[model samples]
Target: MKAPSTHPIKPATSIPALLKTAFVNALIALVLFSLMIGIRTEAGSSGQLTYWTRFGDLASIVAAVFGGSIVIELLRQWIGPTGAEKLVPPAVQSGISFIGRYLAPALLIFTLLVPVMFYNQRYILDLAILVLTYVMLGWGLNVVVGLAGLLDLGYVAFYAVGAYSYGLLATNFGWSFWICLPLAGILAAFWGVLLGFPVLRLRGDYLAIVTLAFGEIIRLVIINWQDLTGGPNGVSGIPRPSFFGIPLDNSDDGLAARLGIEYSPTHRIVFLFYLILALALLTNWATIRLRRLPIGRAWEALREDEVACRALGINTTTTKLTAFATGAMFGGFAGAFFATRQGFISPESFTFQESALVLAIVVLGGMGSQLGVALAALAMIGGFELFRSLESYRMLVFGMAMVLIMIWRPRGLIGHRAPTVYLTKAQAISSDLVKEGHG
Candidate 1:
């Protein structure tokens, strides 16, 4: 006869416990929303503050939060921790994996066709350009924060450096955009190296703080240095990028005139769209290629465990510097493109917010995931415009969406860590198996 187990079976959570948790959560929501959502504040004509209450809206939000809390708790208890994977059937997981394999190539094809399909819609083209710009930025930062596992909060410094480099060279020396582009990238890489040297020994929170200070320092220097950087007013009259050496303007040498087509200003928009698309493609290609190389493998190892990387005799210093330089070079390219696109350069354009947004794309997409970053950029940027009609509630909705995504997919949209190198066949290493790096 078999002996029965002596261990007690775990008890399910009681209804009262669930309600208590919900009530506590609702109370916290009430306190937090009381001032921000419940009350509307404005400055009166006489310089005094005026206020109004929206207790109806406040009560509705609190009640919803309470209900949501209970539902979440119930779901959590049902799923348990290890049950998350089991929730999705094996067939569904196989389908998702199959879709992921083709998703990148399909996305690329769609992006290439965007300008052609939306040739007449100027707004769509412009929005596509904006999305592609962020896509490039996200890919560039992905090298550092994603693959290398380095937390960078001052990436905008490189962006500003690139923009200013192109602006000054073109404006002062009368150099063409093509001539200044490489120079801007080089200068930004140099700055990246400088940043790498100082923070060589720093990691985690310390690294983030130092990088943030570096970005603020660069911004402040641009603001205070009126002679060279033009101070806060920034530099204007920056030349636009040309198709080859020919301009996109209305002159006889303009692209439209040369092509014997009417100059409708849409030509310039389409050209800019293609230009950014090409740059973004180049960024994606280069990143993908580098991931298969030895240095790329080093970055992955470093990300997994710095101690293990050192024990394996990899030079962490060079790895970190190369990651920064490579990432910065791409950022510089995007920044130079931005300066030309806008026909102006300003410190205000490269703010901390830009860095945050790019970082968010990288994180939300999946760290070290090229396709994930691109998709995230599209969602965050294009989705923002989609909610324009929501007005004041747009940000709230956006935030709620992000929160829900985090709750469901904490590792990101595509959290799988595909092995850079594998025997027999390359398979994605589960995120749970990968260490997120020390730095």
Candidate 2:
């Protein structure tokens, strides 16, 4: 055949391809970043628009996009297809597991000593409190979405109910935080059951829409029922949590005075930080324990395939309802803690954005992975704090980080799943194995 096929057919790597990708990326940056980040507007004293053009911001973003495109093109040319699957080396997997084994304890120790280490830094304590709140919320949602695969976008409604329950009970009825906490959880669980009954037949996008609508309904009811909810003004002067009978305020018989210690403003913040930490830890513990139980297994089975679960004689309705109730209970607990921390309850605080962020944390951490949830909450919430100086750009960076994480680890950061009860030896299972169905 004249040795025509002696040479291999190599794909051409053209400059035009690279340039085209670069151009497209640059154009996207221009549309998204140029007009938005490049243009800064503030309300002037005259109540008019005061514009400040930030050409440098636009230039930097464009340059970054162009450079990033070149690198991506190079990677494509050299590596070709990434393949549908990745096979991580055994050593690497073992090393990762080793590090993970110690990471949680290390984080716990660090958190425990943070108050002593940064005793005077009230900001650190406040930030810790905020992060832990999200952590608890993530774990709560994990039960419904991660375990049961319910896709609840209105989880924040339960959170709001818990918070408002505590606020109203503490302010209007003079109930203690300890008492309202459980009651709030019970009430939220009841609502969850109500929600579950309505969405029993819904799935996927339909389920999402119904949950979203439910959340908006709660917020609207709280707003229009001004006589009870205080409307948009919100309920303020909500009592703070007490240590036994001792308050952490500046009063004469408060915690500081009772303990005969020098009063410091950071004390309350530190207490709140530790309080949330304990609550988050409790959520983690409960979730982990539940994962080993019969109901938890049912939840996982339902998540993997509702049809198969029902075919196997599993009661799908009870499974879904229990998942919702359990998840809502945890959300309520976190909400009550939030009310105590803020000492205020408002309809604005329970927006769709909060639900989305909590859901994001659970998803980014790896569905049904408690440790993953904690790490994700830390990264996402702490990333926001790190970019506080960037102002509006913080959200931009946050969005980019989430996008990159999803691209790199589509399943999640720690996507490996271990079977609840092993046959021979307990082994870590690749998430890929269960992407289509149950492991």
Candidate 3:
């Protein structure tokens, strides 16, 4: 009787427990959604579902899952130790306790990414290659526009030079891509220096105008130089990439046939993917190396203050040339890859829009950061891919996204963090232990 009196009859309400239940339910719903997709086509006695219908069903399931997850997430507002504190997660439930924290995000990414791998389009991979190429272009141009504070509108001119250079050598002289690639970069650099010479006396908007004029001039020359550039018809059948002198075509038991891999447009695309990946990586590595060096620092200084950079005994002329040359070289690199990838070239490939996009990437990525540019490229180019189905409306949607990102994170993703800089001591220690990365 005394023990019975000590007990108070009341409903046990645990908010944290409630939240956990909601989270679990949401996860179950997501799993169910995946299962729905895996088994929907096999369902009997149901209306036939096409791709769009299945897509709609999957989307509905996803929405349901998200709705449940949101309820659990809203409970996060009560994240302290108080009347409801016990109902909340304890101390973040660190380590294994918060396993879902990491897995949930990864699952979301995989759900989105895995769909594309099966989209059965070569251009999706091509799109990846294109983004990587532009990322390289943006990084290279960041050195000039972001670091050196020089607005180069003629950046694409060097690209045209590089592409045509590769195209001509590889086709006419029968040069290998290996030899033509460096030559393309060198030729682009030479053009960069040439462009730099006259623009040395210019600055700011005036410099940009001059560079813009130069780019137009180069394109016009290419279009008019029919004797050399094949005129408006441009160059075609320029040759595809070869693997160790083995062409990736059916003619020489090219990649697919020889390797016992089915011949599809993607094999060559995959090769291009790796090649461009290597080039983008090389450009990133070189940029990082240059940043820690005196010249790289000098470029940054020039970006911050041209007068001060000059006062510090740094040659503004040489720095500007180096920036232009470096940026142009990367553009040239992209142009060469483009030429090789398409096996064709025309004035259309080198345009002000290309220059503008690259510049926007650097600006959006926060001028001096490599990772920033990469993110910007992903946002711009990748966004285009994501909305490829949008067709005509894609540009509008893309512009809106950029505006939103600028509104939210103006300094750009990762913002002026440095090509390689330290924040916390722990980060520094861990960074050394783990290798420096672009991320």
- Report how far off residue 188 is in candidate 2 (Å): 0.6
Off by over 4 Å in 1: 1-15, 33-90
Error of 3 at 330 (Å): 1.3
Q: Write the per-residue lDDT of candidate 2 for residues 28-51, one digit (tens) a residue.
A: 988999768999999999999999
> What TM-score goes with each of the models?
0.91, 0.87, 0.69
Worst 10 residues of 3 by lDDT: 430-439
- In model 2, the runs with Cα more than 4 Å from the true position are 1-12, 15-71, 436-439
Top model number, TM-score:
1
- Report how far residue 198 has shifted in candidate 2, in Å: 0.8
TM-score preference between candidates 1 and 3, better one: 1
Tens digit of per-residue lDDT, candidate 1, span 1-439: 1123563434777989989999999999999999999999999999999999999999999999999998998787665543324244557767878999999899989988987899999889999999999999999999999999999999999989999999999999999988898899999999999999989689999998998888888899999999999999999999988988999989998988999998878888888988988889998899988999999999988998899889999999999999999999999999899999998888898789988999999999989888889889999999998999999999999999999888878888888888777789876767777766667
Off-target runs (Cα >4 Å) in candidate 3 are 1-120, 257-262, 419-439
Q: lDDT by residue for model 3 over 185-301, one digit each (tens)?
A: 999999999989987787778888999999999999999999999877888878787887888877646777788877876667777877887788789889889888889878777
Score candidate 2 by lDDT.
0.88
The positional error of residue 255 in candidate 2, measured at the CA in angstroms, is: 2.4
Candidate 2: clashing pairs of residues: none
